[model samples]
Target: MYPISTPSHAKLLRPSALPLHDRGGGARTVALVSPALGATTFISGITEFDPGTEIPFHSHNCEESVVLFEGDAVMDIDGREYALQPLDTTFIPANVVHRFRNVSHSKPMKILWTYASPQATRTLRDNGEIRAVALEHGKQ
Candidate 1:
């Protein structure tokens, strides 16, 4: 972990300066704050979704909060779907199956997400594959 005791440890992150990792099906993510960046309690990042794209249903080992930043989206929690607008926020409990889908066919959607743990992990509902959340963005 990077040292946090000095002012030099502070980081200024710009999404444009980070690499976006493809999550498949037009979804991509950029991990911002994480253990790889000296964050110990939580991890955060932004995800951009192409029109009509959605991530696979998955669950996390820790609680997650997402705030919509652009375009319209649908939040799928378990088997139910909820419409979301710009600035809409959601708090999802640990182990709850959820996903975000961009509803527009010609526009993009983006969200800022934060996970409660530095060691968060995602488990795909389809094949039970697990991945470290930070690593998902190539941060570690």
Candidate 2:
């Protein structure tokens, strides 16, 4: 077996999946870190929010936790809005509506997010669409 880390060294995490997000502003994504296979736990690397950027409203089929690192933003979950700042943590349950926006004039917001399942993190990123939003919001 190939050794990963030493007994005293911390384990390393690296992700090998990429998803599409063509919303607003510049959305550059880095897998940052994730293990190849996890038995029952999921981890996040570093997800950044560009200035004046907002992820459209959507929900996951699994539980997710997000911790904000810097800049200003807001998270709307289940018809409730929560202002976000550095070091803030929020939880969003399965199948509950949620969205995030960076309303800051300057500085980018970084969120160290976590999901209960491996595929949950990419659900919103890969599946969200504008045509459906317009239909759901009755703007069409």
Candidate 3:
């Protein structure tokens, strides 16, 4: 079973502390926190998109929510496009095809995302690739 409690003392994770994955063309992702890191039942991460870079269309088996942290983005959900700004929150229902990209050529966009499950499963809509869905503590 996954641990139910956080550390006795506060746990602080800096940007450099997390593993950074390059998504090509300067786009990067960092798994900020997760049940693997003592979180109860959710996984959170930060994704940074360089100007003109975009995440391919994808969907999660579990619900996901994202908070715009900095810069602007054009979010394409299903078939609609929406503009996002700092502090804007977007909630994506499970299995909804969507994608987002930084619209500014001079600035990058950063988003903080949290998933309903500790191990969120993502399926790339175009290629059918799945990611980040490993079971934790043998929990389904």
Per-residue lDDT, model 1, residue 93, is 96
Score every model by TM-score: 0.90, 0.68, 0.82
Candidate 1 local lDDT, 1-140, one digit each (tens): 32233577788787887777997789899888888777889999999999999898999999999999998899999679999989999999999999989999999999999999999999999999999988887777
Q: What digit string (tens of lDDT, one per residue) describes model 3 on residues 49-124?
A: 9988887899988888999999989899868899998999999999999988899999989998888887688798
Residue 52 lDDT (model 3): 83
Pairs of colliding residues, candidate 3 = none
Model 2 C-alpha RMSD vs. true structure (Å) is 8.2
Residue 121 C-alpha lDDT in model 3: 85
Error of 2 at 14 (Å): 9.1
Clashes of each: 0, 1, 0
Worst 10 residues of 3 by lDDT: 131-140
- The residue ranges of model 2 lying beyond 4 angstroms of the native Cα positions read 1-4, 7-10, 13-25, 32-40, 121-140
**Can you rank all candidates by TM-score, best first?**
1, 3, 2
Question: Which scores better on lDDT, 2 or 3?
Answer: 3
